[model samples]
Target: MNPFLLQTEVRLASKLIMPLKLQLRQLSLKRFRLQLRQLKQTLDCT
Candidate 1:
């Protein structure tokens, strides 16, 4: 395998992965916030 081709493949894979990682992080944060809100509501009710 050619070194240049391998390098390009790695760069492309990283470019694709960066946004996916960011989206996952954002989704997890949203879920965490939702959980905290639910917890607060339950505490208030109790």
Candidate 2:
């Protein structure tokens, strides 16, 4: 295989992965916020 082709493929794969990584991070952050809200609600009730 050509080295240049391999490098390009890697670059493309990384480019594709970047957005997926960002989306996953955003999703986890949203989930954490929801959990924090629930914890606050439970604490308030107590």
Candidate 3:
């Protein structure tokens, strides 16, 4: 139960988690772009 050790653990966890969060964000953005493209195509067809 050391404070310094807890801080280090938090920092390490954040470092590891940040990239995964960024990747998830990127994936969602890509998915959104695909949906927009499909919507545009459907609109054009109509």
Candidate 4:
């Protein structure tokens, strides 16, 4: 196995993983916001 090729593969995986992580974080944040809104509305109604 070539060291350079291995390094390149690792870099590519890292790049892909970063975006996936970011997307997961964004989705979690959005979900939290939606839940918060629902909770607030329920509280207001009560």
Candidate 5:
């Protein structure tokens, strides 16, 4: 229950989470772009 230890743990957790969040965001953005491209192609075909 030491405050310093708690702070350190939070800092470490955030450091680990930041990259994962960035990666997830990038993945979702790529997926969205792919879907958009597919939609445009379908529209063009019609």
Candidate 6:
């Protein structure tokens, strides 16, 4: 395989992966926030 081709493929893969990483990070943060809210509600009720 050509070196340039390999590099290009790697760059494309990284570009694709970067957005997924950002989305996953955002989702995890949202989930964390929800969990904190739920915990606070439970504590308030108790």
Q: Residue 19 of model 2: what lDDT?
A: 100
Residue-by-residue lDDT tens digits, candidate 5, 1-46: 9999999999999999999999999999999999999999999999
Which residue pairs collide in model 4, if any? none
Q: Write the per-residue lDDT of candidate 2 for residues 1-46, one digit (tens) a residue.
A: 9999999999999999999999999999999999999999999999
Cα-based RMSD of candidate 4: 1.1
Better of 3 and 4 by TM-score: 3
Q: Output the worst ten-in-a-row residue range by lDDT, candidate 2.
A: 1-10
lDDT of 3: 1.00
Model 2 clash pairs?
none
Clashes of each: 0, 0, 0, 0, 0, 0
TM-score computed on alpha carbons, candidate 2: 0.96
> What are the Cα lDDT values of the candidates?
1.00, 1.00, 1.00, 0.99, 1.00, 1.00
Alpha carbon deviation, residue 13, candidate 6 (Å):
0.4
For candidate 6, the 10 contiguous residues with the lowest summed lDDT are 1-10
How many backbone overlaps does candidate 4 show?
A: 0
**Candidate closer to the true structure by TM-score (higher is better), 4 or 6:** 6
lDDT of 4: 0.99
Which runs of model 3 end up more than 4 angstroms from their true locations? none
Model 6 regions more than 4 Å off: none
Write candidate 4's Cα lDDT for 1-46 as tens digits: 9999999999999999999999999999999999999999999999
